[model samples]
Target: MAGAGWAPPRLDEFILTEPLGSGTYATVYKAYRKRDTREVVAIKCVNKRSLNRASVENLLTEIEILKTIRHPNIVELKDFQWDSDHIYLIMEFCAGGDLSRFIRTRRMLPEKVARVFLQQLACALKFLHDRNISHLDLKPQNILLSSPENPQLKLADFGFAQYMSPWDEKHVLRGSPLYMAPEMVCRQHYDSRADLWSVGVILYEALFGKPPFASRSFAELEEKIRSDRAVETDLVVEAVRKDQEGDASAAFSLYRKALEYFVPALHYESDARRKEAIRAKVRQYISRAEELKVLVTSSNKNLLEKGNPARELLKEMAKDKPRLCAALEVASAAIAKEEEGRDDSDALELYQQSLGELLLLLAAEPAGRRRELLHAEIQTLMARAEYLKDQIKMREAQSMGKEALAESVRSGCTLQ
Candidate 1:
């Protein structure tokens, strides 16, 4: 199934086309069902002769695991069949290919885009964690995208996965070398946390365009991982990590450190487009850092719960109105997002959606306690919307004073 001229084994109900990918024992093909709908699928054709004893066991384990579990972010195994010469695994087709190709084509992903993918990956991992499953082989090549446009991440290639709980430690080495956790490589016992280390590597590769220890030889990679020297850190990346983790105090400090680096980088950068992007990101971080400063001084809980009394009263008053209560809940969720400070744009969009529903409901209701509370909630959401708009505007603006100063310097140089 792996070598050239190896035709895909015929399936009774599906027509196999070109090969999508090839591995040691199998080749995946893009196929279509023979039914009127002609639905698309991926068929993994594993040549019987290619399977070693261990690979045979892995295949059986993979089939058992995939058949029993289902999650939104995990690739679905629709069906499995085996003939005398080959085994066929019918899977959901992903049009966007694998994450490795996606990143390779882009060179590197924007932080926002990388964060979105990380979130999806984490979601899938959580599902596995709940079921006491660990995907030991977590790498970009094993991750699939649902489609080319606005693709959804799908975790695939679970041949190395196992029914290991968080506390279950294993000494057997598994997974790709570059993406493997240090414990696994050192021949030490490791549990589900090994998968997390791989996740960190995936995120690092996504943001930086390469893993932390990209090397030409096995010795170089091992030395980098096992050496005493700390890997060079990026201030902005550190700041964002802390911010996402809700460590406002640490994030505030890191953001300030990032600004120290960004200011000099901005001044030194000659590329106008790159400078503008950096300037905008600096402004956004500045806004978030200022917000974090206040959050550090005051309890984030207090800031969030400041309006809880009114919200509680509104919820109680709107007991008779299910639609109104649902809208109020959506508004609450939007507030939570804003407080998290993970993505202001997402928070703003949520606020807009919630406001649209609340405004209509308010107009329908007569003047009363519920109406009064609803009105207050609407005003609060409007203020948040305005604040987010100002943040966006500030991030976009190029300083007039700086531009004028540069113009004067250029004119002086010309005269000289």
Candidate 2:
């Protein structure tokens, strides 16, 4: 629930303005400065007690990351202030709501428009990756475009970024589960490349009008990311060989989560302090022998996606990853038996359903020791459930769109 009225409404002397949007834990308000010509800004007021403890830590890391960044593509973090119970984070204000709404209204964005947005975003991400800072949350909601003197997209929200510079240890999982990488679905230390998977999700949404990994529930979503169902081509890639482990196997799930979260950190910051924190637990993406590192084509776009060898390397790791293998085997057997007409006692049904529900509740939890693994499992399950529900909805709406299009054509309107 959101706060009905502002708590201690007066902004510090430095800030000036009113609320922009309301969120459960934080309220983003449009603010301005008395002294500066550049007064267009957003002040986020957060209730300390309601936030996840890690979110606070991540907020501090965001400050550190922002202090070092001077990129045009990234949002400028103007200042920070704290007064007792509240923290005031002031950033450049974006009039445009978010990329999500922008794309949603237009349905499919033109390739040229997408190329422009992707270019700046990729450049900003490239900078973060090089600096060992992984913006783990790269969803459209975090990206703001401005129709200003200098119109452009500015990447915001560093809450989910991992600082690979200092103590990039294998901590609990972070970021929205929907945008998480396949490796992060299991438990593992992750790096900068995980940001790439997020970018991949955004791209998928750009093309399909929704996310590739989606769900009505959190557990079902996790199921989707954990399995091979998400292993699809954004651009065509020659299959070198299959990851011998079957889709049901969770062997490389941890490895997938690792690449999903961490590798994106390595693209920009080659700083050593961050390098020290990269952690041994961060499983490298699998590698295969005797293949071209990349191919250049219209789809491949100068072989950009292949440049990050992390995911491919993880595929090789599929053979050695064993943490979830046994559990997955057991779970798969249970499924098979149920499919083959094994009786499901009411108690058994209740237990299995409760287990899934509990996992999802845990996934929403940002606290806990094995947050990464727990979140992975929760998301995997949720993704699966979400997929089934979405399939049903799509089937129901399948003919409606066609009929509407036919009616429109009959009435003489352009198909688009």
- Among the numbered candidates, top TM-score falls to 1
lDDT of 1 by residue, 336-391 (tens): 88878788788888889889999999899898877888898788777666555544
Q: What does candidate 1 score on TM?
A: 0.57
The RMSD of every model to the true structure, in order and in angstroms, is 16.6, 24.2
* lDDT by residue for model 2 (234-336), tens: 2112121232333211222323322333333333324433432332112223221101111111222222243224323322332443433333333344334
TM-score of 2: 0.51
lDDT of 1 at 315: 89
